[model samples]
Each structure stands twice: as structure tokens, then as C-alpha cells.
Target: MRVKDFIWLSGLLTVISLPLSAAENDWPVYGGDNLHQRHSKLTQINKSNVTGLIEAWEFDTGVNDTFQATPVVQDGVMYVSLPFNDVIALDAATGKQLWRYQHDLDKDYPICCGSANRGVAVSNGMVFTGTIDARLIALDAKTGKKRWDHRVIGENTGISEDASKLEDTELGSVSGTSGAGINMAPMIYQDTVIIGITGVGYGLHLDAVDSDSPLGTVVGIAGKYGRRGFMAGYDIHTGEQKWQFDTIKSENWEGNFVTKTADGVELPRNITNEKAALQENADAWRYGGASAWSTPVIDPYTGILHFGTGNPSPQMEGSSRPGDNLYSSSLLALDASSGDYRWHYQQVPHDLWGYDVASPPVLFDITIRGQPVPAIGQAGKTGWFYVHDRRNGNFLYKSEAFVPQKNMFSLPSAEGTIIYPGVMGGANWSPVSVDARRRLVFIPGIHWPVEYKLHQQAASEGKDAVRYSSMSPINTPEKHGLLTAIDLDSGKIVWQVKTENPLIGGVLSTASGLVFTGEGSGELMAFDADSGEKRWSGKTDAGVNAPPITYRIDGKQYIAVAVGGNRLFGFKTGQKIKVWRLP
Candidate 1:
């Protein structure tokens, strides 16, 4: 019974649990609340009228490719989740549409990065979503139909057995050989629902040859590919299964092999060939690959649940997945009802530079020393903005390097290296926004610097001779985008700005001082949440990447987003959704 007496009796059953909240004008869920705090208490549209806004409607969803969701809304409808998980309800004031459900994509499973989905979760009257082939479905929030589907992984679960001779090469045509699915965005918490599991740290991406343009080389390859990566809980009526957790730790997952970084940084390990290859990778947590990407930040006064975890499998080639991958690039914390394990902070233990805590964790409270605490911010892809201690994941400070870190943890080189926030991040799966009365925190970074390299391929004819690692973006530092705002009690950098295009997508903050974001060049912008100033922008035909939300109906105050673009950074897709108001 002692694991520090069950974490001090789970912090006294999380300080007498029962709060739940979320309705301050409704964006409903997925960063708007459950402490995701995408902030927006609705103050009409500030920064002096947000340039008089305009265009209060625009619904398309005709199925564009990487849109990346983030629409939610409630009582006034608006559900929105496309790029193939399909399910739209819209009408949050005239963007009409009412009911659509669709979904169906099994196409023999295997999905990774481009089937998008990121947005759903409305309570009891249903509307859940989490698909791209790992299933989960719910729908029926006033006629979108289908109530209950749940198949979160298990058809060929993790494929590999030479997955039909590696599906005929080029790493199975750029990773479609199965990375398992469910691109996050499913939260509920009372009768359960929660979600997770994403391309299980897969790898081998390679895209930009002008197929719209952005992510050109990812690679990874050093065998056993990927598998374990969980976070479950279902049964918001009958999808059944409850409580799952498992982001690789079937037994010490090699923890304590720490060569630094619980803040002290260092890590370029070898720890003597990883303790002489830890008994031949001791079952490598059965293909352990962490991938829960983002969408979890519960803490309703402490029932815990925070999220983040990605990169570990063969990703960036960490010697057959050796040690310190415990909860892969960690930030976990659970017990939202029963998934247990209460704390973890690990931002990049043995991560080999994919550095993924893929952004999404933002509770808030802060004060410290003068004592108020309960913290948990998190926008790192190794470019900082950490914060922690939401109960006991501890660390407590780190902000001020929104995007630009140069050789960070180093390692992969057969003559390449470079590194600045590589692996497409400095907040990838983007989602960060919390003004909690100006304690600030608004990040949306990604300066894109990669190179890395390491390759060696040979043995063809019948396959079997590889060892890889690749990452690309390093043409000489031109990529851009950052937006920061820090301050969380002086972890300082209270104003950052600089975006021409590398920002992924997500950030909203408001009470009306303002902070909205979007771009791959279709600009949605608006700033000055406290002097970052670029007050308003708006134009969009595509590439708003995804994430921007706000609500309120009869009394106006709109501003939604999800203009399709972002086919893994090439941007410019399009199926619209738009919204906006004031005028």
C-alpha cells in the first residue's frame, strides 16, 4: 500500500474530488476547459473591437486533408471533426449544417499523421470522435446519429511481421505500414470517454517534394517499429472498457538511468552502451513507443489527468529502445477517476531529439513561495515553457526560449546534426493558452531547424539491412514562427511575436485582452494579450492550420477556426469553417 502511501492517498482523494465545471460561454471541451485552459471568458472581442471582425459564418467541411479540428461548442451545437473522422453539427449561430456523421474509414487500417481528426467530445448526449482508424465513435448529439462504436486498436494491432514484406519498401510507402491510430481529441470525464493513442511513435514520414510542402524527411528505422502507447477509458454509456494508462512501463521501463534532465539538462548518454544493452532490451516494453500526442488536462481541482507523451520506439534511433523511456518524453499524471498513476514529469529522458511532450497541458494557479501552486503548464517540444508541480510532478519553472534551442540534446550524426527544436516541434500538436488573469502563457512556436541524419541501408533483394534516423529542415535557418508570452510568475519572456510560417496551430487566450493564432500563411492572428501587440488580421482560404475557438451565441461574441490546410505542414488544404464576429 505504500507508494508513498498511495501518493498520500491520492492527495486525499484529490482534495475531496467533485468539481467538474466548464461552461463559461461554452467552447465545451478540447482545450477550452477541463483545465486545458485555451482561455476565453468572452469579453466580446477586444483589443478595441478586434479590428471590427466580420464574416460570422462559413461551414464547408467538404473533407479537406489535415485540418486538425478544435471546434467543440455546446448547447448552441457546433461539433466539428473532419479530415476523415467526419461528424459535424454546426449552427452555432448561422454557420448552419445541423447533422452529418460519416466516418467509415477502415481501408485496411494503418494510418499515421494525415487523417487528422483532433476535435470532438460533447457529453451525455454523445458526440465523441477519435478515429483515423483506431475507432471510438459516439455521435448522436442531436441527430449526428450512431451512438457507440469503440475499437481502439486491434485488427492487426501493430502490424509488423514484415507487415506483408514491409508493404513493398520505402519504409512501407512512407509509414503507412501501420502506426496504429486515433489522433487525439476525445474528453469527457464523468461517465468516462477520454482518449489517446496516436501513430504510436511511428516515424519514416518524408513528404515535401512540393506536394504542397513542409515535412520532407523523417525516417527513424531501427527495427521493432512501435506498439505500446495507451490511455483509455470508455463507457459513456456502452462503449465499455474503462481505465487503461500504459504509456510504456510494464515494469520500470528502464527509468533511473538518468544522465541528467529532471531539469539539470546534460543527456547525450551511452551510459556504457546503455548498461551493456540492458539484457538485450529486456523485452523493450513490447515495442514500447509512447505516442499519446495531446488532449488531456483534467485537474478539476485535482482529480489529476494531465497529458503529453510521444517519441520513443525506434524514433531517432535510440539503440533498440534502451533505458529511460518510462513514460516517453513524459508529462503524464492520471487518476481521472481510475486510470491511477498520479505523477510524472520527464520532459526528454532518453528521447534522442524527437523531444516530444507534444504540447497540451495547461491547468493553472501558480504563486509559489508566496504559495498558491497547482501549476502544470507545458508547451515543450524541447523549446521550453514547462512549469509543472500540479500536485507532484514538481519541476516548477522553465520558460523563455519559446523556439530556438540549437543542438539541444544532440546525438544522431553520420555527418549532419544541426538541431534547433527539430522533429517538427517546439510545440507540435499545438495547444497552449491560459491567461488566468494575466499570469500569461500563450505559446505557439516552431522555428523548424532539423538536419540530424544517420542512415545506412544496404541489404535489399529480400529486405533486412537497415539502421536509420533522418529529420530534415535545415537549409540554413530560415523557417520561422513563435508567438510566446510566458510570465507565469516570472519564468519570464512576457512577449514574443515573430511568425511568417512555422507555427503549427493552437492558442486562444482571452477575457478580451486578446491572443488568437493561426497561419501557414492564411493568417487569423490578433495579439496584445498584454503587449505582444499585432491586434488583428483575419483572411483565410486555407492554411489556418487548426485550433482557434471562442463562443457565445445570441449575444454574439464568435470567432471560430479550422480552415483545413496542414497536410503535415505543407498547409493550404481547405474545407473552411471560419466564423468571426463583431461589427
Candidate 2:
């Protein structure tokens, strides 16, 4: 292959918006670009002046719960989303709230995950977000007023009004269940606006927000007209649907429940949109796991859509759906144009720990062996880090090991040992930073256990009885969290900075010869990309799940982070975005 073509095919240079230092390099979308690199090109805030950073300003985001919002900045204006699904436009330099678009979320949200709004995607002079309340909203980039609202999920997505209004009746309960809602920021690929639904049969059933009947199809709505998740494309100016993809089957679903164990293969309690329909073979989609819950990474150049899946339903039980659930807890590669599964890698076969591969996959090319190849490195919620070939989902580097015989799966020869990073992900929802300079992937990871206790009406009615329906907070069993630098080529840990709390928030590395990391304990820190020594850090009001960003306004280098305990990540306070400028 030609060197240039080989590098492109190797997954290097995903054609993301080349950050141009100023407004040109704005961290505008979730993952920074379609590839979700969470990387930046600014070097002004490098290791040299990093320690001199002093608080410039702070904005009151007014949120409660662990907020993990990646702010989108455009034209000197910053757009941030929060746990309550509130979108606010702020002055980029001053941190002043310009306009706030509240999602109208109630104190009680019916979903397993706590209140978290990943963030927003902007284009054509409008800010877009998939709301916790199940609506896809577009706002004026300048004023933050709602331009149009398309009920992408919930009742607006064709849900019954009564059903849509159901409260998160199961929070703090043992069942630990939540209903349908949009949490991941809506993905914008070129002109088509894509969104996915998480939470699950939650309090409702699977397919609760499976909106639009045929359920589980990647709907592409138009940017112009207001089309909702219906029809197809919306006019760039009209917001109308131009086209649509529906999950309709020619026949009813059919599949016998795994009444008897075979080779002790766990019976699949759930199925994919395809299997769900096949198992029913009747006319309805099954009620188990099988939902599109993660934001997809797009190969803007190749137009391939890569997304991860959630656990097959029944929450914690895997015996329900056995035999390597086709796509659940899997990484799927599809033709962005046709939505066809080109290839897939099941991170967890029939996941029982509820280890959903819902985290965003970071894409970049690694100089493997002697050839630079296109590959992906992913950190899942369960804490597993996987480096695979993006072109075909092949393992490029294997650092984290499999569970071996820990998970009771009888193998002819141990197959591919399930060495997942764990549900909290060796790298979780908190993103990682990719340094092109050193070709290293900087990931903050959680090393904790999520001991699941089978919920059986829990004898009577107490906390234990309703725990499954709750979001488990962080408890790091004393093992210091790690900020691991992995040699992408070898999947080898170059250097690991062990901190007190789990290395929780996202990461950003700069060309200025420095790397930035955050913690769930309100600690924003800096480290030498080449060394593991901590050069600086500071305590704020809450944990830092929100990644840090750097930019230059008037030749002065600046750093910033959103301080709010991720109610979901174990933090309970903090409501401001703190900025620091080099003195």
C-alpha cells in the first residue's frame, strides 16, 4: 500500500476538524471530533507555564450530580451541557453565562445512570443536544433559545404520554433500574444528525425509548427542517426529515428461552435488534438487552460509523441470553452510508457484570512493528482498555489481561480470554488524551470491583432490596488510581501516575511539552508527558469528570475544568467551571 494510503487505512488522521489553535481548535463536540480523540493542538499551555496558572474566572453551571460535560466552543463562545441536560452558552474568555437552555428534567430521572449530559454538537450556527427528557433540541448558537425540538425518544418519539411521564420510580432501590432517555451527546456526521438512546427497559421495558416502533435503527434526521427521528433527513434550513432508517422485519421473532444449559453456555436472555425480532419471530421486539447506547465514532474520511453496545437486558443476569450475544457489549463497525455491520468485536460475551462497552472509542494510528496502522483504543465503563485494528477490529496491542477462568465460560482452549478493563473501564467514560508527538495514549483508569449481589425481592424492602436499580458510586478498595501512559504500538504501560482517587475525568495532552489530567476528587493536575512526576494540581469544589481544555485568547495561555461531583461518579457537590491563566 502507498505510505499515505496505508497511514489513512491504518486509522491515523481521521479527518477530524484540524484544531487551529484559536477558535479553529475549539473542543466543539464530544470526543473533540468525529473520531472522539479528545485531543487538542494548542501548545501555549505547555509544561513550562502550566504551574503558573491562576484562576481567571468561574461560572455557576447550577447542577447537582456528577456532571461530565465536554464544552463546545465556537467563535469565542462556549457551549456546555450538564447532568440536568442544561445547555448554556458562555463567554469563552470571561466564563460568564450567556444563555441557559434548561432541559426541564425533574429531580427524579428514571434511568440506571445518574443525571449526565455528555455535551452538545454544533454546526450551521446552531447548538444540538439529545436531552435526558428524550428530545433532540437545536438552539440558536448565540442566544441559546430553542430553535426546534424533536422528541427523539420517550413519548415524543412516539411514546405514550402516560408512559413518557413515568418518574424514575426506582432510584436508590435494589432493582436499580431507569427508563429510556438520551444521555450521550447527539453525534453530527457531516449533514446528518445521529443520536442514540441509553438506560434500558429501565423502569419501563427494553424499547422504552426504542422510539418509532421498529425500534433500534440509526435514525438520520435532517438539519434544516424539524423532522424528529422520523422520515429521514431534515432540510438544513427546515429541520424536516429527508430520509429515515426503520428497524422493520419481514417476519415475527422466534427463539426458545435457554431453558437448559449447554456446554454450560449461558443462555442468551437478550438479542440484537435483528435477534430480538428473530427470537420473537412473531411481530414484537423482545424485552431483553440490545440497545444503541454509545456515541459512535465516525471515520469522516471513510464514512464508517463505529459504536459500542450495552449489556443484554435482565440487568445483571446473563443466563437469559447466552451464546455470545451478537452485538451487546460489543464494538460494531458499520458503513456510515448503509448502517451495515462490517465487523464487530464482542468485548464481553453475554455480559453479566453489566459491563457495557458504552464508552467512546479513541481512534488513532500507531506505528506498529515498523508500519503505522489504523487502530482504535477503547476504555469501557468496566475499566478495560482495548487496542484494536480499526479497519477490522483486530487487537493491535494487548496490555490489560483477560479474566481467564474467572468468568465461568467453558472454552475448548480458553478461546480469547476475556481480559476486559472491567465495567468502570481500565478507561471509562472519562476520555483519554492522545499525544501525536510521542504517539502515546494517556488514559486515567479505575481499578475497582463491582460486586453484584443478586436482587431477589431482597427478602423485604430496604436499601439492599432495591440496589440494582441504583447507580453504584466509586469505592477504590485502597488501590491508588492510575494515570497510565500506554505505548500504543506495544500496549505497554510507559509510566503510571498512581493517585489517591480513581483517575476519573478526561485527559488532554499538548504539544507545549505537557500533559493534563483530572481526578474525581476535585483535583486538576498536570504532568510531564515524558515523565510521571506531577508538576502541579489544585483542589476545587467537586470531582473532575469533565476533561480540561486549553486555548489562547490574547497570547496568554489558559486552562479550565468544570467542577461538579459527578453524582453518578460519587461526587455530590460543585457547580462551576474554573479557569486558570498563566500568571
Once fitted onto the true fold, the runs of candidate 2 whose alpha carbons sit more than 4 angstroms away are: 1-24, 106-112, 154-178, 201-285, 291-293, 381-383, 401-423, 454-479
Q: lDDT (CA) for every model shown?
A: 0.78, 0.59
Candidate topping TM-score: 2
**Model 1 per-residue lDDT tens digits across residues 465-546:** 7667677776554888888888887787877988888888888878778889999779889988888889789998888978
lDDT of 2 by residue, 404-450 (tens): 12333221121222322334545556677777557687877766543
Worst 10-residue lDDT window, candidate 2: 218-227
Model 1: how far is 394 from its true place, Å? 19
Model 1 TM-score (2 dp): 0.34
lDDT accuracy of residue 228 in candidate 2: 15
